[model samples]
Target: MNQDFQEAVRDTPGGTAEGQVAVVTGGANGLGEVIVRRLHSGGCRVAVADLDGHAATALAEELDGTRATARGYAADVSIRAALEQLLADVLADFHGVHILVNNAARTQAKPLLEITPDELDAVMAVNFNGMFNACQIFGAYLAEHGYGRIVNMASLAGQNGGTATGGHYASSKGAIISATKVFARELAPRGVTVNAVSPGPQDSPMVRSIVGEENLESYRRTIPVGRLGNPAFIAEMVALLASPDAASVTGACWDANGGLYMR
Candidate 1:
């Protein structure tokens, strides 16, 4: 297996997987990392899957040196074969998987008109295709197992054409929202739930880079809440949706955009 698919091995600060075995895509950095940590703290055995194998392993080791409850697997969500291998590796290491968080994504700051075809394809490959395939592959397995949770990382941009992010990113997320509903309906009867978390301008590196330090305060004022969203809180939303308690909720997009957009 490639290093990307290698299962390396985290400790639960507070959390069972059912035993709660969770595989978090793009779990090596940013919001995805936070979700990984949050789930681990909530007693879930976590598989920190990311493109950066070394970083994933480091985080996994930091969470659990013993590698009993936490581990890292490297994967490129855009590649079907890589994802398939990831599933096999995770199952081999964790025995059973109960949660799947589709957080892997790509974005560019290029303007819509200037956006090259290649750029759009690259973003969609990771943000949409990767997540969709994971749902199909993992959803089937979870349904077969008779229980599972799937929380996808959506964005307010998908609903409102995006702010600072690229056009391709927004389109990918919009597709994600639609697919979340479809998958939820398809898997609901099998004891599996599929949902999405859409966040607005968050206090994350990505947002910071997009908005820039000089314009951040001005941008915050445009938000109804007058502040950027918190990444940790967004992670909490993912955690809540992934919990067994949230079995009743599916095909829903929970928003945390600080009133940036409202239904």
Candidate 2:
């Protein structure tokens, strides 16, 4: 190991992402919000895209009052045209793009059998269809540029069939895990890496609501780590995968489930 490089990382964490531009979907709140903050703090120019434009702008301005390093956009990824427009908008604003983070998703707690067709379609539109379109649109731009990084958000539910989040949500995530590999293999030759970060029971609002505040202790005890995962740490993992040093990590699904589900 290079002790000199280690010291430099300690002194300036953002050096790895310096000069890189990243677009994060669903970046207005929850896990997406934390990931945006982490990347921005690491010196990456971040474009915060979400359905909620107001919140996204607030976060961007909060990070950089002059809008030099960050900006927010309102986008619905389910629409292919919208994703294409998002690509154009980002390129116009940033002059170039390098990293994309797919963190936008919808979670429902309905029972497996009770999940209706309409409900499943709604979830898939946002989680699966949206992600698939992004991979195609952005992946193309990245391939044309000959370099890019895509980090998709997966869930432990996808691997274990889930206990609280609905079956549709699990299925969508499982699809994402598979898509990551497909995109990874195709983009590898083009100098682009597509990967995923699968998280389980986190200290996030979604998990809190699913497990209930009163039963939080019991939920913590069930996990092997005896605690919920930290969103900041998850963001760090996303940032790592987005960094230049992670070129060799394509097609990998880095798990952060606190030992809840392991390979």
Best candidate, lDDT: 2
Colliding pairs, model 2: none
C-alpha lDDT (0 to 100) for residue 186 of candidate 1: 97
TM-score between candidate 1 and the true structure: 0.93
| C-alpha lDDT of all candidate models, in order | 0.88, 0.89
Model 1, 116: alpha-carbon shift in Å? 1.6
Residues 7-113 of candidate 1 have per-residue lDDT tens digits of: 21122232223357899999999998999998898778899999998999999999999999899988999998988989999999988788999999998887888
> What's the distance in Å from true for residue 120, model 2?
0.6
Q: Which stretches of candidate 1 lie over 4 Å from their true place?
A: 1-18
Error of 2 at 46 (Å): 0.6
RMSD to the hidden true structure, all candidates: 5.4, 4.7
Query: Which candidate number would show the highest TM-score if scored against the true structure?
Result: 2
Per-residue error for 151 in candidate 2, Å, reads 0.2
- Tell me how many residue pairs clash in candidate 2: 0
